[model samples]
Target: MTTFGSQSDVIAFLSEPSAYGVSDLVKRIDTHAAIIFLAGDRAYKLKRAVRYPYLDFSSAEKRRLVCKAELALNRRTAPDLYLEVCSIGRLDDGSLALGQGSPVDWLIVMRRFAAKDLLDAMAREGRLEPKLLRELADGISRFHELAEIETHHDAVGRVRSVIEGNRVSMAKLPGMPLAACDRARLFTSSLVLLDQLTPLLARRGEAGLVRHCHGDLHLGNICMWQGKPVLFDCLEFDAGLATSDLLYDLAFLLMDLWQRGLRDEASLVFNRYCDRRAETDGLAAMPLFLSMRAAVRAHVEARGSDLQPDVKGRKDKLVTARRYLASAVGFLDRPEPRLLAVGGLSGSGKSTLAARLAPRIGTAPGVRLLRTDMLRKRLAGVDPEAHLPESAYTRETHDAVYAALLEEARKTLDAGWPVIVDAVFDFPATRAQVEALARAVAVPFSGLWLDAPRDLLHARVGTRRGDASDAGPAVVDKQLERDVGFLGDWQCVDARGDAQQTLEHAIAALGSECPIG
Candidate 1:
């Protein structure tokens, strides 16, 4: 054993594979606050001996505590990834050894997975399938449900702090690309919006909606582990940062996907999570949540430019930072509210079209997709894939579902957010009711009736798996027998072909009526 007494010695010891009893090849990755060393099947994360305004790891004791905290917090979502916190200690022979003697440094040991399995890498490689995204959304929703609710903090105050922090940080940045006027406008708009939502935020907090969540929920922090999406590397330094409205936590991933130009994927995750959680009421606050998330990323990226070693790297970071700022501003620039109803048979692609059109339709994070299947499942207190008995689809139950959908749409439109209803309006009364609901609210309404061949509809329903809609081939057959009387002025979308073609046709038919795209 070699004698060591300094930080450089500890680093040198860890840099060698012999220290880990593994291959000679050691991979090192550095972040602003931590250094990760990957050796063979295990990875060790050591916090940098640095202090920032938001975090401090300057002391060995503090680093050890944070390492333990990180293990505990991240284990909530990724128990398999975070193994344990190990101490790098001075052995009896005076050499630094992992898990051997008196502590000199701390590291969080983890089970290393392939880097290509990261959601960000999958997305970049175009391997991020819709099924995987749906699974990820469900995983996040479940995590939020089980997260501890924070009762001590004021939700509004937390958001206000973030808004103020972004402003102050940007102001302090030297040669920031964002204009002062632009920053002022965003700050003012955010404050105004916060003022309007204060009561709602308080009510949600009181209702236990504010939870200790995964603060940094971007795609990069998620990865495929054991054939499932596992969330790891959660914010652990600041409890205040991690404790927030669940939707606000969700907005980080949404903003990341939107910035990556994956609008459809972003919309799917949003709608899927909303469906699983039944969180339509919070849609009004999403724009602010998304803007705040973007702003946080902006200033963080801008600050990152200062940490870069070269001019080119700094310039690239600055450009990314500016784009994030622009995205933050763009999130607040909402369009006029409108109501879109996509009605057809069970497998006529109503839900598919609604999901596809949602991201293009309204404000930043897209319109509220109110699907009847999800509503029925929620009302029945069953999982979306849980089969519903025949009694569950009675006429009375059907009326109740439609009424709930209409009421939700009304509230969404009142909040100045667009909505898309996905349901089977086989009856003239139901179709008329939907049209009247939009008219009563005095918002532009577009009714799209998707028509497809019977065989395709039956086949589509037959192959359904893990879908909210429990409708089968028998249900499609029953729908085919129903007489759907004249859908006056409703745009008939021929959804007999592939999904993309059907979406294009529907968008073209709606044209200026649907000003979303």
Candidate 2:
């Protein structure tokens, strides 16, 4: 049995540095549901004894259980950061102490990390590097792969519930800043998208795509730990809220990045995650997922606005909530899907152009980039940057890679997302096959064949390091010897200059079809 105690006493005890036997000052951070005290090298998180519609921590036992649950859940991705759950209770002589006498509340102890190490802080400071983003996406993919699959969820109903909840909350928010018509449109459009995606959601659930996932996978919840991104603060109060389609889980981060004007970073994370997970078919639901995630944020901010201590802080929060509301509406207005193929011999800067162009092509995070080299590596069950043997580059293997690339492009197109297939589509058959996929999918198609001097190509391939492509100078020589078929309808771009110049030419060739921001 647990005994209820005063929260102020617990807070005062945790706020004192001497409580941890440390001389350093203790810092405190608060949220609606919890309070964290940072002392020395550790953080103590205590659940607030409050009851909400979504969760209950009104009892000492409830708080203790939730504290234990949070520790267990977070340890899955951040084992080193989470230590143990500690009980706060009254000691002899009626003094509050940790793990001492009659238990009153519980707290999760965690290793303290620098505030600057948080991804959100890094994003605000323009320190989010591409390498870090890629690694983070890969880490997320691996985590999702190992998450327990959920089979009993009414996946569609769950999503529908979120949509309806957002609608209700947005409409009834205190000092609702949004116009009535705008709120109506947001709900109406989101519900319409939900109706259209109901079947796909159910099918994905049947396919075991739904799973227990980090319910709150935002940048703020991720931090740099031991030179890598570590996910923490997973939603532990409610399993029903935490379980979702993995793509839906990922959309929270993607939407977060996009909302922060980190479109390029968002695109990189999205593409890398797709490369790692191959969740291309779920792209159709992305608009809905992204919208719902933003809607959730909007309402959360709106509700949090009321808790602000000052008028200016309250107004600032409402302003942010409305901005998120607008973004939520925009996410649902997905553009028409398109297919683009970037083909060249090794060192023609085809991959470079594809990457630069993808973020600006369509929608928030842009196109799914499919590179044959990466595909080949994936086929061999190796990391994307791992080098392969010459045997892996056989004609049969090349054909198989092209086949797989086209199939993936087709699927991504069917999912109503733009795709850019990067490959050496030199042979007529390979070129025609990719072009045929666009026609089959009824999406606009464009092909850019990069033409660079043989010397430049040789120089490019010779100096390559940590690249997925195994092509060297010898491979470049062989490619130069083979006569590339007529350019046909594919636009030719001069790649002799630097990558930017080549991208400029390709974008010019793409013209109105490829919308650049």
Cα lDDT computed for each candidate against the true fold = 0.88, 0.88
Estimated TM-score for each candidate: 0.94, 0.95
Candidate 2, 247-303: lDDT as tens digits: 999999999999999988998899999999877788999988999899888878877
- Candidate 1 TM-score, C-alpha based: 0.94
Root mean square deviation (Cα) for candidate 1: 3.2
Q: Report each candidate's C-alpha RMSD, comma-separated, in the order given.
A: 3.2, 2.5
Task: Please identify model 2 stretches exceeding 4 Å from their true place.
Answer: 1-6, 177-179, 307-309
Displacement of residue 212 (Cα, Å) in model 1 is 1.0
Model 1, position 327, has a per-residue lDDT of 86
- Candidate 1 stretches with Cα past 4 Å from truth are 1-6, 92-94, 174-181, 306-309
